[model samples]
Target: MANKTYSFYPGCSSQNKASSSNYLVSTNSMCQKLGITLNEVPDWNCCGASIGYGGGGELPRIVLSARNLALSEQHNAGQDMVATCAACWLASREAKERLDHSPQMKADANEALKEAGLEYKGQAQARHMVEVLIEDIGYDALKAGVKKPLQGVKFAGYVGCQTNRPFGIAGESFENPLYLDNLVEAMGGEAVKSYDQKVTCCGGALAFSEPEKSQKQIKDIIESAYDHGADMIVTPCPLCQANVEIYQGEVNKRYGTKFNIPVTYYSQLITVAYGGTAAEAGLNGHVVAPAKLAEIAGK
Candidate 1:
């Protein structure tokens, strides 16, 4: 099949090494192997994140996301806006939802956009990249692209928030999403069914404000995956990956635990499984390092 291209939103994390830069590298590599092209949104700014919701009024938050949509429509017209970050997907998708459904809200957002010399006609459709992979590309196609299966490496598919809540992607259970699990299995890995924290929050942003409570949440997420015999946890959200992976050592120290499970982006796994090198998948930048799967898949 021919390659499918869409307007891409790599989010703040994926944009730089200061954050989840590996996501950008891995995703780009994986998409190349999968025949999906990502044409990044031009001059994209922040989606305002969760704090944007609390600190500012609705119009500001809406405009923050709407600007991207408007720009995509302006520069990359008719292509669906795809995001790898869950917060980015939620913020953008939520803006589209509010803007599309309520004319007054849409008008108000558009009114704000006029100041930026842009207008949001609500033309762009917001989508999670994983949904595009599952709905548009199909799991069978993903399996076929895997040059190296993960084999017996047990995996915990952590969906976290964003992609599930507000609006689920295509055909996924918000409570217990199987898309990640199916993707893992399709790539020739075992998706541990007993891992119950599949859709729980990873204490995003709160990891800074409330380390104790946040660490507890992260600990459970990691411990559960390990308890279920998972060598690592894979997720689609950049925040989830950052929060879960970055805080592991801290969580382990605070809780007197020795949790060493790695947290990885699904794109990272996809890239390597399809015969891409570790550097290509950005494996070198992982906080916990997916050495378990890396050893199996030969990083």
Candidate 2:
């Protein structure tokens, strides 16, 4: 068991995004067992919530994530900051990149941080907790810690767009990403596939921006999974979870087809299958009942 501790930025989605909460809670539990404590950065705001960047203003991304980063810099100045939300991860990582490479941006960010009694010296590393677990904490070690093995369960790993996109700057491959799949496999479950739509969007805020398109996207993914025999769809995004779960009833009502695929956070499924309580991973809060998941586990 590793004793070194790392800080975490739960991001706004962690609370608003159901699956975000599930991933963070489970990751926290697992990290605790691994001698790693995921402490929250103080007074962090939304990572601009997808709308912060469109207007050509970097302040939202800079200040929001910088506040969190500055907190980590205070205690572990040169250490890495772990992000659970892909959006939050991107925002913070981008901010870190700007601060480290752009001197002018650093000056402005430091001015803003001064308001909160924090300073941004451009030394913190922004990383996905998934990366830390896989790269820093070897896979085999994670296997040894598994109290319950998910040997028979089949999982559909959904990485959503933000986790792996826009190529190199994103820190992971958009075309050949396998972190989620590998994490699932580490827990003793087989990460299954459905269709190309698996990597497609879950309509995100489209319910408000483009309801019809969002619905169609959600419909396509659900139907694709159904066609491909995916027992469940596991994702790391809260927005995707909301779009899929909140609109499942709407999809069913519209299509007259019963579509109730259990959409769970990767951490939630791993936590449950690894002999941890589903509630600990916040599975009960899922709009889609985990009955199918329970059934699979029973087998």
Candidate 2 residue lDDT tens string, 121-194: 76678887766777788778877787767766666777777766642223456765676777788887777743
Q: Which candidate is the best by TM-score?
A: 1
After TM-score superposition, the amount by which residue 35's alpha carbon in candidate 2 deviates from its true location, in angstroms, is 2.9
For model 1, how many clashes?
A: 0
My TM-score estimates for the predictions, one after another, are 0.97, 0.88
Q: Give the whole-model CA lDDT for all candidates, comma-separated.
A: 0.86, 0.72
Tell how far residue 113 is off in model 1, in angstroms: 1.0
Local error of candidate 1 at residue 153 (angstroms): 0.8
lDDT per residue (tens digit) for residues 1-299 in model 1: 43998999877877776588988998898888888888999999889887787887788988999999999999999899999888888999989989999999988988888999999998899998898889998998888877888887888999898888868777667788789899898888889988999888888888888889888889888888988888889998888888899887898789889887788888887887888887888888876888866675564
Give candidate 2 misplaced runs (Cα > 4 Å).
16-20, 54-56, 167-172, 295-299
RMSD, every candidate, angstroms: 1.3, 2.8
